[model samples]
Target: MANRRASERRPSDRRASGLSSRRPSIDPWRLVPMDKTVHIGGSDDFNVLFIGAGNIMFGSDEGPWNHSFRFEHKLGRRLKVVALIDPAIERATAVLQKKCDSFVVSAYQDTRVFKTLEDFVKNMAPKDRPRAVIVGSPPMFRGSLAPGRDIEMQILKFFPGVAMFIEKPIATGPKSEIQDAFTIAKTIQDSKTICSVGYMLRYLKATQMMKHIIDENNLTVMATIARYACAYESIAKPDWWDKSKSAGPIVEQGTHFCDLSRYFGGEVDMSTVNAHSLEWDENAGALSKMAVDESKIAPENRIPRVTSATWKYDSGAVGSFTHVVSLQGTNYSCELEVYADGYMLKLVDPYVQPTLYIRKPGDDNEQMVRFPDDDPFFSEVSNLIDIIEDIEEDPEAAQILSSYEDAVRTYELTWAIREASERSREAAKLKAAAAA
Candidate 1:
C-alpha cells in the first residue's frame, strides 16, 4: 500500500526531495586487476656519463673523499655508467676495475671510453644519450675563459638540459679563467639547467638540523669561524704541490670551509676580503719540518703552509677561515662555528663522524648531537637524481645548495683571499727592503 501511495506521488515531489535519477559514473580502469608478480615502486634506468676518472671520481687510496663510489652504492641496479671521457683512458679503466673487484659490483663493465667529449657525442646514438653528466675533470680543463678548454659549455652544446654535477674549484688556471667561469653562470641560469657544484658538506643532515634550529629560533647570525687543517705530509701528488696547477691549498682544499662560511653568513663583500699566508722557508724551523720536498717546485711556485682569511658578509656579519697544511697521517681536522645572540652552534669533524654542539639561551651546558653514519656524498647524488626525475618530495631536502652560479661566488672569494695574501707577502718584502 505504501509503494502504491509513493507511485501515486507527482515527479515534482521526488525533485523536491533532492533525489537524483542518474547513477554516479565508475572508472573502467579501476575494474582491472593488478598483476601480483610484477614489482611495484621501482625507478627506471638512470644513465650517467663521466668526464674524468681520477681520485675525485673513483676515490683515493686513503678514503672516499670527493668520490663517486657513493653514487653507485646509492642507485644500486638502476645506475648505468654509459661512458668515461678522459685522455688517460687506461687510468679510468684500472680504477673502475679495482673498485668493482673490491667494492660493490656495478655497471662499469659496460662503460665505453672516449678520449674526448666530442668523440662520444658524435658516435653515440640518441637512445643511448646520458640523462646526466659528471664533470670531474681537472680545473684547467673547465670554465669559459679558455676558449677551447671549456668542458661545461661543450657539454651544454651537445646535451642541452642534462643534469650536471661539477666538482669544486671550478677553474684553476689564472685570474682570467676564474672570470671566464663566472660568465657561464648566466648561460646556466638562462637554460634552466639543473646543476650542482661539488660542495657536498651542505647536504649533511647535521647541517640541515642546524639550519632548522636557526630558522626555528629566528636567530640573527653574527659571525662564522672555520678552520681546515690538512694532513699535508701524506700528499704525494706532484701537481698538487705546484701552486700554478692546483691554485694553492686555499683555492683547492680550503674551498670547503670558505664555501661553508658563506653558507652560514650570506654573500661576501669581495673588496673587504683580506688574508695573510705563511710561506715555506728552508731557514724557518716550522716550514722546514714537513716531509714533502720543498725544493721540487721552487720557493715562489710552492703552496703556502698556512692561510688566514677574513671577509665581511652582505648582512654585516663578519666571517673568518684559516687553512693550515701542517698535519701528519690521514687525520684531517676541520670545524665550523656559528654565533648569534645567546646561541652557539659548532660542527666538528665534518669529513668523518660529524658532531654538532649547541648552546641555547639559559642552558647550563651545551648539547651535543652526533651523526655517525651520515654519508653526504650519497645524499648529494641521490638528491640530484630525484631532481632529474622530478620525484623530490621534501622541499627542504630537494634544494641544490651549491649551484654553478653560487660556486662561482665562492671561487671568486677564494681567489680574492689568495690575492690578498700575495699582496701581504709583497708588502712584507718591501718593508724588509726598506729596513735593509
Candidate 2:
C-alpha cells in the first residue's frame, strides 16, 4: 500500500481516520513537559569539533544525509566547525571542496584538519575549544580499553563536560574490546557529561507518537517483533562482509532494531537471549542462491545471510528480531510491530518515509499516520544542540534519550545475539560430524 502524506490528507479525512493534524511536541527526557520559558542558545555561534570525516560526519557520494552537513544547513552562519580530526585529513578537505557549496565552504573557511586527535588538541587553543564534539570515526577506532586511546575518554579528559554525539555500533572488535568499551560508560556518567549515542530512530516523530499512544493507554507491552532486511548485494566494502571486522550484520546493521526493541520493551534479560542463523552453502534453501560471491572468505568469517534472534525483556515481555541481508538495491525492508493487550502498533519504512499503523481495541481497521520528509538525523542533532545550549540554565532542561550508558546495554544485547547464533551454528556442525 502507498503511504499517504499528512500534507495530502484533508482535515475531514484526518478526523475520520482518527489522526491529529497537529505535530507532536518534543518532550524532555522521561516524558517531562518542556519549559518554553527557558532561553535556548540564541544567535550565538555554536562551535563543534569532529573526530572523523567519514560518511557519517560528511555526506559521501552514496548519500547526502550526513550529520555535519545537516547541522551546518540547520545552524547556517552560527555554526562553527572548529576542526576535524582524522587520519586521512585530505578526505575532510575534499568533502569541503567538492560536496559543499560556496556558502558552506565560506562558513567553514576557518575549519582546520589534523591527522590525529592528539595533534588537533596540541595546536588548538582553549579559547577555540568547541562546546560540542561529534565522533564519527570507524567503530574500531572508537571506545578503546586502553587509556588515552578512546575518543570518548580523551574528549572527557581534555574537554571536561563537553557534549558528545557518537555514531552507532559504538565499538567493534573482539569480545575483549567490546567489554572494554562498555567500561567507558561509567566515565561518561561520573563526569556528568551530556553524551548521546547515534540511535536517531528514537527521535522519529512516528516513534514518539507510538510512545505517546502506549503511555496514554497504560498498555503492558506483550511483544515487539522487528525485521531488518538490507541490500547486502550492493555492499561494496570488503570489511562489511567479514564478521571479524564488522561484528557481523547483527552487531553492525541490525543494532538499530535491537535498540528500538529495547526502547519499547525496557531492559532486556541477557540470559534469556537465544538466536539462530541461515548459513551460506551450495545446498538448496541456503544463502548461496543469493548470487553474492563469498567463496574467498572462510565460512567462519563470513556474515550470516539471515539471523533470527529472541529474548525476554526485564518487564517479562518477549521480543524477536530477524535480520536478512538479501535485498537488491537500496530499498531496505524494515519495520517494527509492538503488541499490547488489545492494541497493535507497527512502524514501517523509518529510513525514508516513516508511517505508523495503529489498531486499538474494538477497531477492526488500522489507522495510518504518515510522517513525510521526516529526518530523524536532523532531529537528533538539533535536539543535542538544544540540550547543550539550555544545559547551563537548567540541568534538566533537555534529556538525551540514548545516552552512552543506555547504548552500552543495546551493544551488549547485540553481542549476546551474535554469540547465541554462533553457538547454534557450532551445535549444528557437531551434530553433522557425529552422524558422519
Candidate 3:
C-alpha cells in the first residue's frame, strides 16, 4: 500500500464507529438517523474507532472498503474508518489500495499494516485505540494464522481491548477446524472483543418491512424460490469458492440461500436434489450453454447450474430455492418470491437498490412498492456498535440476526445441499460410465 500522500489523507485523529454520529453527504433516498434514536447498552455514549482487515481470495477487489468509505464519506462525522487491509497490498505499490475508489473513500491499509494481529493491538493508544476491530474479510481469505493454533492465539491476544466483526460461516475449515474457531472466539467472553459475522442480506430493508406485513396479516410463507445468478466466469474460481477449501458450493454459495430459506420458512429439511456434472452430466447435453460454463469450473467448487430442493420449515412453511449460473441481463441477479397468507412479495436485485412487488390475494397482479431505500452500510456499522455495546451475560441469542453459532447452523444446512448435489453428480457419473 502507498503511504498517505497528502496531509489531508492522514487518518482522522478521532475515529467514530457508531453511524448515529456520521453526517452522510450523499442524498440518500430515505434520510436515516432521522429518528435521532441511538441504541446502546448500559454504557454511556462513546466515540468509536473502527479498524477493518481482510484476505480476499477471488474478487480481491471486492470487500468492506468502498462501501465502508461511502458510509464514512457520506456520514464522516458519525463513523469514520481508519484502515482497510488485505493481501492486495502486496501488488499495489500505492499505500491506500482498496477494491474500488468510485465510492470516494480513502484510507486503505498501507504496506506492513500489521505483520501479526498482536502488534496491531499494542499500537493502539490507551484511549485512542479502536473501540471495535472489524474482522471484515470474505469467507475464505486473509488470515495469517491457520485455524486451530495461530488464529486462536492471535485473536486471544487482541481480545482485551478490541471487538471483532467476523463475516458469516465463521470459519471455512471442516468440522474440527470450525470447532477450533469457535473455541478461540469463546475465550473473549465479556470483553469488547466481540465476534460478529457479516450476514448483510438479512439486514435488507424490504425483509424487515415484509416481516411486519406477514405477522400482521397472519401470512404463512407457503412456498418460496430464491434464484441467484452471477457472472459465469465469477463463480468458477480456485480459492474459497472452490469446494475443497471452503466445503464447496453448499458451504460457500448455498449457505446464504439456506439461511434465507430458514429465515422465511423456519427450519428446513432437504427432501430431494438432483445434481449432475456439467462435463458428464446427462443434462449437460441438453443445456449446452450452461454445460460450457460448468466445464470451466473445478469439480470441487462447481456449484450446480441447477439445484431445486424442498424444505419444510418449523411452522410447516414449505420453501424451495433454485440457484443457477446462467446468462442474465443484470450485472448480478437475485429473485426471491415468497408466498404467504393472503399476499406475496417478490424481492429482486438486493445488492443494488432493491425492488419489491407486493401482491395481495385476489389482486389482478403484483403491485410494485417503491422501496424506501435505506443505507445498509450504516445499518451494518450500527449493528456492530450494538454488538460491542452488548457484550454482557448472554450475547449471541440477544442479537437481532443470526450470530456466529446461528451462521454455523445455516452453513450446516447449506452443506446438506452441497452434499446432495455431489451425490446426484456421482450417481450420474457412475451410470454414464457403466453405459459407456
Candidate 4:
C-alpha cells in the first residue's frame, strides 16, 4: 500500500478491521443531507473511486469482459482514479501492477490506499473526494454485523447524493436482513442520487434491440423460459458454491435470467411461484466422480446442485427458470426465450459473447442479431457517467435503466424462488412422514 502524507492520515486509520469498522452515523433508513439537486457535474476531469478490488476489476482485464479496463478506455485522459479503497490493499496493488499499464499505472503512481472508509473520510479534503463511486463489494456486505449496520448502508450514509454504480444481486442475506437493506434503498431514492445498478446485460445492444422490437410490435407476451447451465470450475472463489455466502447459483449466477423474466414478462407475483430442487450430498458417489474434496466445502455454504422454479407475472404471463451446475470444463450455456403473440425472442450468454435471435410471424427463419458495439460493461459505466453529467446539466433529462429500487424487485423475485423451493422440500418431508 502506498503511504499517505502525514496530513492525510487520521486517528480512524488505526482501526484493525479496516473498511468493515466504519459504522454509519445516520440511521440506515434516514435520508442523508443533499446540498444540490445535481450532485456530479461540471468537471472536465472525473475522479472516480472503487470500493472493492477483486476479480471483477483485475481478472476481467484479460477475460471476455472487464469493467475497469473498459471504463478507462472510454474516459481516456479525462479519468483520474488514482486510489481505490479495499481492506486488502496488498491484493489491490498487485492486481493494478499486473493487469494495468502505461497511463493506468501512472494515474495510481502516487496512489494512497485507505484501509477503511473512515480513514478516507477523515483524511481526504472535500476537493479530493470522488464525483462517482463504483461498489464492487460482494453481496454479503449487505448482511448486518454485530452492531446491526450493513456495509452497503454505511456507504449510503457516508456518500449521500453521489453518483453510484453498485454491482448486482444488490444484496444477499436472511429474509429479515434483506428487508432492512431494501428499507435503506428507500433512503437512497429519497436522496435522489444518480444511482445505477450493475445490471450490464440491460445495456447490451442486442437486448436493447429486443426491447425495441417488443415495444414497437406491441406483442402480447404469453410465457417465457430461462435456462442456465455452466461449468463452475472457472470460479476464482470457492465460496461461489456456498448458498449462505454467495446466495447459490440462482440468486448469484442465474439472477440475470430472473431479471430478464421480469424484463419480458413484467413483474412477478411471489404467491404464484412454485419451485423444486435436488440437494447435493458430499458423501454421495457423485462427489468422488467429480474429484471434489468434501473437506473443502463449508457446512454453512452447502446448497442444492440443481434448482427448477416457475412463476406467473402480474401480467398473467408464465415463466420458468432452470439452473444446473453439474457440467464439466469451461463449457457453458445460458438462454432466455420469450414467447409472445406471433413472435419469439431469444437472448443468449449475456455475460459474454451475447447474441439474439428473433422469430417473426410467417417466417420459417429466425433472424440472428449481433452488436459490434455491444461492450455492455463499457456502456454500463459510460451510461452512469452520461447520467451524472446530464443530471448536472438538467436533473429531469437523466434516466438510467436499472436503479437500486428496480433491481430490488429482481432480488425479491429470486428470493421467492429459493423460499418456495424450501417450502416444497418441507412439504415433501411432511407427506412422507404421514405415509409412514
Best by lDDT: 2
Model 1: per-residue Cα lDDT over 154-219, one tens digit each: 888999999899988787778766767777888888999999888888877777777667655666
Q: Report lDDT (Cα) of residue 431, candidate 4.
A: 100
TM-score of 3: 0.69
Off by over 4 Å in 2: 1-41, 61-64, 99-101, 147-149, 282-293, 391-398
Pairs in clash, predicted candidate 4 = none
Which one is best on TM-score?
2
Mind sharing the TM-score for model 1? 0.87
Estimated TM-score for each candidate? 0.87, 0.87, 0.69, 0.83
Query: Relative to the true structure, how large is the alpha-carbon lDDT of every model?
Result: 0.77, 0.78, 0.52, 0.69
What total of clashing residue pairs does each candidate reach?
Answer: 0, 0, 18, 0
lDDT (C-alpha) at residue 359 in model 2: 97
lDDT of candidate 2 over 102-214, digit per residue (tens): 65764477888898777888999876689999999898777776744588888887799989999988887676676667689988888888898999888887888887886
Off by over 4 Å in 4: 1-43, 60-65, 98-101, 143-149, 282-292, 295-301, 391-398
Model 1 segments more than 4 A misplaced: 1-43, 98-106, 282-285, 288-291
Sort every candidate by lDDT, greatest first: 2, 1, 4, 3
